[model samples]
Target: MPISSAMAVKASSRINSMFRILWLSAIVGMLAACGSVPLPPEPPIPTAPSAPRGAPPLATPEDGAPLPPARIQGRTRWQPVRWAELPGFTDDALNEAWNAWIRGCERPVPALARLCPEVRQLSIGTPEEQRAWMMQRLQPYRVEPLAGNESLLTGYYEPQLDASRMPTAAQQVPLYRPPADLATRRPWYSRQDIDTAPQARAALRGREIAYVADPLDALALQIQGSGRLRITEADGRVSNVRLAFAGSNEQPYRSVGGWLLQQGATRDASWPGIKAWARANPQRLNELLWSNPRVTFFREEPLSEFDAAFGPRGAQGVALTPGRSVAIEKDSLPYGTPLWLSSPGPLLNLNRLVFAQDTGTAIVGPLRADYFVGWGDQAGEVAGRLKQPLALWVLWPR
Candidate 1:
């Protein structure tokens, strides 16, 4: 199953290349600069109100004077809790999550930087030792929405595709890099505009980085904001490379899947559903692709063995660990924060320690999260259909 393009959301801005070039350097040496990648696209869902479901009225004073607001961050009220309150706290494989934590230590926040040495040492520590250290140094806070306990957990992944350096009869659809005049244009040529307008096409004429067979394939690459492109060059050389998000055309993103549903075109709005619709109604394929006005541009990067092991660098400027890195709403949880995620899943039940290493536009709210499921087809299958109830507890420094 393929996810909807709407799942694509902006990641952090690009950091320096030092990390890539010297990836094997000590964790501290690897902290050169931060870079950006886009969050995988999931279909758009209804936006929940930023406000909590219902907040209790402020306590009145004896003199009928309203009490000042309680100190809090974002739209959440952090309720402190005991470590035992977290379900499956002792069951998670702490060592499995240590890799993500160590990555965070590469460029740790002021509060957590001091703990880097300990975090690294504990990478191979026993679960009991790690658990004890956490309990000794961190406080757990239940992340509560102001109005309600409603929370959502979704999944996202990097897409992989076969591509070519030059356009071929089979691989005619082009994936482009940003145009020279992109910044000057308030909103660059749209998906439809680029397809139909000569001038718009001219701007991107020499900017094609690679070409793939299906238009939807190109769109998926754009929607994911980044992907693995196994490219066969014109000279008969083949290599696997990463296409990282460079920029968007500034046009607002619209959900083509949602459009299909609204138009009564199909009940299945997943990527597979969209593909089926495209196949059945080739004449309307352009109309479907053009429903989303935004266009994402990407730059190519060499995918090294080390890089291949992890997903693209997230908003936190570190490579994301599969099942261990989660895209969060930055307003509610800062990057690098450790979290206990418990979800009663109809697809997959997850109770583990994950990190707030990325953020997505759709991954908004105090409790909402998008789990990074890694790359390739298997991961895409999980990301495409994962939507379940969620609960989170943030482990903060004591």
Candidate 2:
């Protein structure tokens, strides 16, 4: 195998070239496999400066846009009242008897029935007569049951009567003027003032709350304070009202409930703090936020002509027109759902709107409703008119 030196060199060069070609081919195969295998993209890095230390991010609407408008839709039917054609309905004795029946006092009903058998007879009469009779009976009492319940009435009852009974005509005099101003009057509380005193303390303790039938009415109550209330009757008559003050031990939670909820002040949320603030500022607490200079207390009646004015054509009575009533599941019905009720009645008028915001003490059953008549004469008239059974529809935002 001994060959020439030139020939040996040539053979070595050929061997080296073969090895280089094989290495290149192996590198190319690895590059092709890598191209087929997918790799994940890298996440982006924030370029903006960091927020200031210890500062919370500003709150904004989701997606940095304003919220959508509320979509509310519903209809209320009109419910009308039918009055009785009984003789002597407007007489003084019958007026007294009617008032007694509306009060529903056990003592008064029997006496009232004896005096005005028409009321008893009408209770079972045609719906129209029943309504009319009921109105005539309830007018003098000034009490109307709240909507949606048969047993629970929401109108104010006269304060406990004193022993020296005054004639009904004599009682009418004090009803016009506002109750004596209590602001200048010394606090009814002495160190001995046990009842309202304890209640005041408990209210601070978060045990008592305030409530009202209507939010607007609550405003009036706040302004009137703890003194007597006055109402204006439909016939331009006035009367004095003795209001029931929250007993010292009994909480006024129901009376002022709306005010408390509106204020965002709660017994739970710093009761002691509120008490301290109230103690420091007594005058500010007594002043009502929604006091109207033009609106005065109507001593002889609870409602004004304005209160009775409803519907497109200011009709004289309440009517529940068709396609306006609504029914809601017991669980979903919230207080103060305005409704338009409709049903068959003597008055073929259109359905009307009413505030469904009040709840009866006894109106817990489902599918019931309460209709409010403006206070005093008109109220009595309207109450008497509401005898026909009509379906109600609740109007709400869709």
Candidate 3:
């Protein structure tokens, strides 16, 4: 939804008004024809199209809500740039991004729906041809947030962990399902409340979906939203199943890593850092967990070999494509929007075409994005370590 420009909006308002008037005039004209009744005086000419090339670069209406100004920046702004400005535009494989783009097409936003056919037709093109097609059909808009020249780029992934079907002495921690009273109450319970309050525990009794041996592992799954659980049942059979997002307690989220920083306990504010702290202060683990009031609940999904390669469903209801799918502020960059990203040496892959396919609560503000690394421990390792500055350019329809 790369916010609309002022000219486009003014144009759209006039268009809407014109449509209404036409509808009304057609009704009145039919009546006049039948009884010789004079038509109402003609409405003043529709707002004149901008003179001196006054029209906005584009005037297409968006999907649902009226979008904010896109051509200009307030908190986050887009400025037109040439495709040549994009680093590795031709060098990168557009095919690598094609699948992610197709995933977005599974549920295209209205403004992007028209482009779906063309996207499907071009999916099989060579990287060079695809590059040329993008250069011709899309405009590169350099994005910058109001406060800074660049925004932070972080990573997140699906975690794989060992699990048990039921609570055991060795595997005592529990993963819960939403309770029936969840619908009846607002902000049902906080993380601290769930751990310490008898009432909260009572509410969640008999709702365990699975149990884990490590408390931190459970928290990690909650923070990541979803993951794959390798279950080891009493019968000695093990199978991998996905724990997808079900619901969350209606409580405000506080980053445990952020809380650690405020207490002057750390500088490296990543998952690994949190785990390191947990290892050293084993007794105070609950204190750290309680710092984050919000708690997330999940439901188990069967994972097939094919499904294991992709990520859990995103806000757009499409499985996230590792390395290519990114979570952006939909109000700023609509899902399915293609972005040309450039980062300094510190980032793993500096430049690539990433599709906006997912979103997260922590991923707020303009020009901000979270890169999905993929599933398993390698992905998690990369995600936890990422904290770098990034530059982004949206490849919007020309």
Candidate 4:
């Protein structure tokens, strides 16, 4: 289903406003470097983007949500650096990032947990105040990968799709929860087996949570590991829900995008390109999907108005802040560590503060990060196309 017109406008306006601030800051930095004038008052802090239409709101720390254990910081080298080494440090809207930091505090590493009370008070503080607190209490360290490879940045988003409570001619593809024997089978059925093997089908019988129209949509949701679903019930009532990652078939993931490139099937392997290829070659769609052996299962959650403001809970067990939350290789950085992320972008030039609040299977290495771009088609477009060189500096507690 098409996004509501109002949502499109709000998303567009938010993005445009963010870019404008970045552009203005760049000019201010250049002017200060030239000694042309003193720095102007800091740019207004941008507020969080509105939740997608009908999307659930975010839950807060006050909700007393259970959290996963924080991962240990990895063996990556941290070359201590002066705060001056961080680009755009002064220009970043710390108040904007404070929201992510606040979320990170929910499951903060032990050392950082002690600082949460102050972090909470700073939520309403000014950029200067937040920046001062960070500079005073945190030590900056440049992240150096053990492998000595250039750090790469990619993007992922929570896919949003329409669904039906039961299968229909148009919405025949089903998204399943873990099968009854999901745990008993080590390395459960592959994608092809779930479709072709009678035993596999039997296990998944009556297990579908919802049905989507397009197989590709199901695949996208699986790959992302979570998604938002706008569901139509048997009684014609509509509701929005989330599909959170529960378990996965133990088979290793294979990139269907990579497979497409190998076959010279299409030069553009992003979702839009893949969908275009599918439209032209419907007969080969199953072959394309089965190239990825792994299959993820999910559990459904109701989307309440209170939980609608944020993205789904991430690996860290906190709702992700659209532009501020990132999935890191736990071996590279611990969950809830703040960092200065500098990426000279072909898609977007980003020099900002972000938190390591999530992890992904493909996100490995010291320099690697998968930026969470949020939910909806606009965010989806950005996430699908973003793959850039990244530089990181960990901001650790002193």
Reference-based TM-score of each model: 0.81, 0.24, 0.79, 0.81
- Can you write out model 4's per-residue Cα lDDT over 1-398, one digit (the tens) per residue? 12233432333334323333443344433332341122233334334455567665422211233322322347577877656678777678878888788777767777677666556555555576566556545777888876667778999999999999998889999999999898899999999999999999999999999999999889999999999999999999998999999999989999888999999999998888888999999999999999999999999999988567788888887889989999998867888889899998889889899999999889877789999999988898999889899999888876
Candidate 3 residue lDDT tens string, 261-326: 999988877888889998988888898999988888999899999678789989888889999988
Candidate 4, poorest ten consecutive residues by summed lDDT = 59-68
Q: List model 1 lDDT by residue over 84-108, tens digit each.
A: 5788876788878888887887666
Evaluated with lDDT, which candidate comes out highest?
4
* RMSD (Å) per prediction: 13.8, 35.9, 12.8, 15.2
Name the candidate, 1 or 2, with the larger TM-score value. 1
Native-referenced Cα lDDT, model 4: 0.79
Whole-model lDDT per candidate: 0.76, 0.29, 0.75, 0.79
What ordering of candidates by lDDT runs from best to worst? 4, 1, 3, 2
Clashes of each: 12, 70, 5, 7
Q: Name the better of 3 and 4 by TM-score.
A: 4
Model 3: residues with Cα > 4 Å off, grouped in runs: 1-75, 146-150
- Candidate 2 lDDT trough over 10 residues, lowest sum: 311-320
